[model samples]
Target: MPISSKIARQMEEASWIRKMFEEGVRLAGQVGAGNIHDFTLGNPDLEPPPEFVESLRDLVVRPRAGMHRYMPNAGYPEVREAVARWVREESGVEVGGKHVILAVGAGGGLNVVLKALLDPGDEVVVFAPYFPEYAFYIDNHGGVLRVVETDGQFRIDFDRLEAAIGPRTKAVFVNSPNNPTGVVYDAAVLARLGGLLRDRSRKLGRAIYLVSDDPYKKILFDGTQYSHVFRHYESSIAVYSHSKDLGLAGERIGHVAVHPAANSAEALVAGMTFAIRVLGFVNAPGLMQLAIRDVLRACIDPSVYQRRRDVLHGALTELGFECVKPRGAFYLFPRSLEPDDRKFAKVCLGKNILIVPGVGFGRSGHFRISLTSSDRAIEASLPAWREVARAYATV
Candidate 1:
């Protein structure tokens, strides 16, 4: 009689992470904001670089005629060309404006690509402990999500992935420097993945697209670099955003770069462009597209995040928490001190600490900690974190 059953079920599934954050906010009011250790969201707290700000200001003050008007559904020609040039340099693949389609954000870009690709009942493979929204995205296009778990270190398990491949499999979604787990997929692993896709495609007599979600591509730590998937996988679609890297998450601007060498590249790009329009995005925010076009070279300093990661990871591990030191992105997945992560998270809440249970990201026996908050938040939260850990130690 009210919302559709489909939506009701999806909402129930997606509520856990948001519920934690909301509870954290409600508790903050009760205990005073500084007393709660909230690590439930990956919202980056850093401001955009000075250049990005200047570019925005410049664009606003010296407005071009019809600057706010809609350009092409694929995005402004100049913006697409700029993005294509950057992709070419980074991926070492020759792509031009025609291969790029701009969308509201990485999430929107993914939806657009999925809309263009998935027929009803098609299967999409995803690695577990992934961004939970992926299930919703795949479902939006009438595709089923077939999940395969990652290795102990959160790296891709090639054997398991190979086994997951089947005739219905149309795409494999990858998020390197993954959201819940921050492990970066190395070049060697990417090469292997590419080879597998090639062989599988030949055997099945079909093409399996590689969808690379890369919002955290530029936020890496320890001098690590992201493996450009397009170089290894020809039938790859790179969904990228300036949200995490430029601290423009609220602006919602990103693009999808189709591999120039992909099979029927022009057709794929056209389909993505049409999908973006039909899905109601029409185009990415004009101001943000222009804001990011020239400032493609800019990034919020990774060192700031690196220092935060070092402090949190080192302090937690020293206090007896098992954590995989993240190489990119702003979240850390730490093994729960107790057997049931939900109960362990509740124990944390008792200590005025809020964290997402690992099951929210398709894993259990652990929890996720978003390190994107202010350094003051991390430093202030440490004592409470230690108290929670100590409580678990005794249990």
Candidate 2:
């Protein structure tokens, strides 16, 4: 039987990260895993904090009645309450259980929010060099994605963004400590963005939701500052996950937080609850939700990633590669040796080094390197990288 046209199209546009990763695996078999330096995925190498493990142990041994059973579509009331208090303390938005919706993961939370807010043909604004999955998520909800290009430094280009907002625009999405580039947006810029959204909402006579995808909220380096969106934007929803900070990517534990000060918080929250159920994620995993509830403040130390970043950045720069110094996240967006990023990535692959092309992230003439691998792997890959750089220079 033929597959659906939509699935075929989506498969065609699937992640380059995974594609390269699979290639890396195939190459690993040929030349042992240690010989192939794979920087294709942001899969953290660090283990989850001791608190996370201890919590899981505590929950497992003291299994209460219905501990593994289904929960309300929104999640358990106690988990929601715990998340609410955490949000209140962190963001000072004064939310409660009514405003928190547990989700499968940050990606799942984003899908739930889109399902709740978007009408058919409505548009969701996203900055360029964004997470490619954003397009699929918006399309899944019958929403159109409007891509707005960012500045030279990958900061929001307000001029293009303001011009892009029109009557059909339903929401704007932002990912701080952004993927691909690892540029953490400044607080002033976020405030300005919130003001712009407010002004546009008034002019359009409707509320425009600011959707903040912040899975890397705590992965900062060297005094890099960060803040919650609820502190800046009124009509906002924060999608968070334990994937990056707690190294719980496979656990799929996360939540959607609707700002309490939003114009119609109650309705949005209700829509999110309904969306989670209808989207086939009746509720987030019961066990992990309970496990994460108590470890809200726990995170693996970021120093390991930071050291790796410094090592790779310094080594690559010395070899003549140009890249922005990443302030957060474990990825580096560096200019490809030549303008054709795909060709450059292929050239690196020939040397048993794997990296994703920037075209996958909506940009060309660049590539992304995820530094979530071991320091030994990075050190091992240096010779191959330097050889690629030298060969490009000669050509």
Encode model 1's per-residue lDDT on 118-164: one tens digit a residue: 99999999998999999999999999999999977888899999999
Compute the lDDT of residue 127 as modeled in candidate 2. Answer: 94
- Superposed on all Cα atoms, model 1 deviates from the true structure by an RMSD in Å of 1.2
Per-model C-alpha lDDT, please?
0.91, 0.91
Task: List RMSD in Å for every model shown.
Answer: 1.2, 1.4
lDDT of 2 by residue, 162-202 (tens): 99999999999999999989899878989999999999999
Candidate 1 Cα deviation (angstroms), residue 34: 2.2
Task: Return the lDDT, model 1, position 341.
Answer: 95
